[model samples]
Target: MAEPVADQNSALPDSPPDGQGEATEPTNANREAAKYRTKLREAEAKLEATEKRVNALLRAQVESLAAKELSVASDIFDIGGASIDDLTDPEGNVMSDAVDAAVKALLAKRPGLRNGSAPWGDVGGGRRGSIPDAPPTMLEALKFTRR
Candidate 1:
């Protein structure tokens, strides 16, 4: 082994070694447990309330859509010159099948109406059956003699 360097003896520790110190405990650990539990309960209650409101909102949306559909069906009935109330049963409710049938018949009669186009109009077909014929002219009565 090599001889010790001159100043290495002075570098060695002069005092005894110190032991590891005790760990510090938090001051209010037990006191805050109840408050944290109550905060969690409040969050859960808010979640449940929000869930119930969402369900109610969905129900209202469904009802509004149903009413709008019925109004559309009523408009279809009116197009064929019949009111929905007149076609209703004794119980005062319109049948879905009748609404379906009326809309189908109208669509079949006027296929273009469904595609946002007007149906073709019929040209006048001679004179109407209700009107009487015009009397003969005075000149034709005197000049024409042959049978």
Candidate 2:
């Protein structure tokens, strides 16, 4: 069959020549909404992080209380296995290292309670000699004044 000739009589719609359609510029309202959405996302992320930190702190507190109760009930505290100082939050507050606290408690009732010196075996050589229970730090030594 012979192909029919196409119709050229109808006019095309009076619109912009479609290359790519016109890029719509964002309105001020659209820009403001986008800004608010970004801010909301940031706020959500910040809230999530804060919640995690708060949960950690609460868990630590619960653990601390449990440890104190266990120590006291087991006579560890009474027998100087853990001191009141150990049960408390230490200065500068490393959040409750239970093992460290317990060890401090155990060592609390030492020669310092009496007028006795520490066992020489605490230092090297295990020989019978008295040493200061706590040696001075480097900072303390540096402060020495010898005229």
Writing each residue's lDDT as its tens digit, candidate 1 over 1-147 gives: 998687965786554335322222233554587789989999999999997886555434433332333334334544655453544566645555655566566667755445333345667767656654677688777677654
> Per-residue lDDT of 13-108 in model 2, one digit per residue for the tens?
444555433333356558899999999999999999997886566545544543443433334444545444454454524345664455355546
- Stretches off by above 4 angstroms in model 2 are 1-26, 69-147
TM-score of each: 0.29, 0.32
At residue 1, candidate 1 shows an lDDT of 100
TM-score of 2: 0.32
Any residue pairs clashing in model 2, and if so which? 81-105, 81-106, 82-105, 83-105
Best by TM-score: 2
